[model samples]
Target: MRHAETVTFGGSGLDRAAALRSMPDLMDRARREGTALSILLWRGKPLVQAGSLDQLVRLPMDHPIIKSGRHVDADSEILLGREADGTLVFAHDMSSWLPAGLEATSLNTFLDASEQQHPDLPQDAVFAELRRIMTSLNARDAELAATAKALYSWHASHGFCACCGVASEIAQAGWQRGCPSCNAQHFPRTDPVVIMLILNGNSVLMGRSPGWPDGMYSLLAGFVEPGETIEAAVRREVMEETQVQVGAVRYLASQPWAFPTSLMIGCEGIATSTEITVDPVEIEDAIWVTREEMAQVFAGQHPDIAPARKGAIAHFLLRNWLADTLD
Candidate 1:
């Protein structure tokens, strides 16, 4: 595999059995015959080992907690994919479960460190924010966690159909929604964003959003608007945000960012102009950093910048850039 394929949340060869989605009896049969294993999610947090938050805590399809979840919401079961062992795997949304003395207000804060335990689950297992445990899980678990979280988030916000403005029903084993009123089908959509590594000689451009934690900066990125290609987006976003003119844009890597589902297309760009004019409305600040300073930042020696967040495509790209491995 190429180095880019090793990015966090990258695929682990999970066979998404798309053909079996039309079989209405498939899920029922799998669950009834105790032939499937399931991972659990509360809100967007995944059930993982509490202390280390490493491995995903998979439960039998017939486990009591999952059975109770099925009773509450029959549509909660989502067919993730089949594992290599030929075992069916599913993700159960247990978001409806409420623990005692819960501070519902602060459930999913910016970086939620809290974990909630389901009474029926083992003491060591708890629901944790995927962001907090993403790097700890193996590639397979990371892919599953990211997939399940993004799917659940889409369902929660898209209960109503866009075409008919009416309630839609989940279909295709949670892969799509169908509107009965207008018969409009909506599939899960991933927003495409272009993150640029604009290099001018020995320096690269970086920026931080308005509310980002202090001293944290990343490659300039923005959603690819309608009628725009990835290269177009790279140039446009860099120009729009920092008044930089980019030339010769090339794709480097791509990452599945599941914080509400975005495909971050990484690109390298040659900066024709280095001057920056910040658009306060778009970002808080923008600046150029030398490769030497970036090396220090990654090593925890930079005085003004926080380390690049691990598991983020920004970090992956920057690390490779420093190591000369962006092949």
Candidate 2:
């Protein structure tokens, strides 16, 4: 775990100026000082400029063309940061405008086309574009995608205030929603998920859900229920899914899984029992694999198993585990 922060989306020293959230004058001053830039999001996807796939594609703060756009009004933008003495830092939304490749395309159609090519886009490029220019963005692009997807989904479902039957207004830089009638503040939520590598000497346990692609097994994971501790959740999830007894859980690392706002807490657990008895309701299959077998999966040489998806914490952890770097 010495290099835990080196994981994708794990470390990026961006200054998330939290103190500037409430001061309007400070934010304006920051913008005027030219230290502010806009990250644009279109339909939840960050807008990446062509060819700048490795770095954040920031928009010039004073770009005349962006300022003249009809939909580029003040309300569509949010101030994200300010310096120590109060300076405006901003991010703008161009979701109302067409993206680079889809100038005349509809959002729905554009999404469909993009999905088809998603697997082919360079990981760095995809990550760079979404991290800076999108709503719900993170310092890492994939994390941003996950954040945007989750937050937008929440907004879509929680349009009405839970405390009172009134519409809520977005606030706190899209991180919260407020109900005017009931005076309630609702913040964006991140669910806790425990994903663990259950180890028995040289072997590790993995499971696949029913709907997953063939041979797509991953570390056992489940949501941490109310009142459950992380170690307890790891034990409970393993028992529930594979009927295995786990002991001595050790924290490995964590990733901000924006897939609808989940925080994946990765851990390693010592298994007391190895008999596989998968609960059909929880997992389609559970198996113990030796490190040699996992090496094949990672190298794309496994006959039946596909490698874990890139950008996922599971993949990150497994890769490190294989390299004996989980320490």
- How far is 211's C-alpha from truth in model 1 (Å)? 2.0
Summarize candidate 1's per-residue lDDT along 220-324 as a digit string, tens digits: 999999998989999999988999999999998888888898999989999999899998889999999999999999998899987557888899888888887
State model 2's lDDT: 0.67
Using Cα atoms with residue i matched to residue i, what is each candidate's TM-score against the true structure? 0.96, 0.79
Supply every candidate's count of residue pairs whose N, Cα or C atoms clash at under 3 angstroms.
0, 6
Sliding window of 10 residues with minimal summed lDDT for model 2? 110-119
Which one wins on TM-score? Answer: 1
Candidate that scores best on lDDT? 1
The lDDT of each candidate is 0.87, 0.67
Query: Whole-model lDDT, candidate 1?
Result: 0.87
Q: What number of backbone clashes does candidate 2 have, counting pairs of residues 3 or more apart or in separate chains?
A: 6
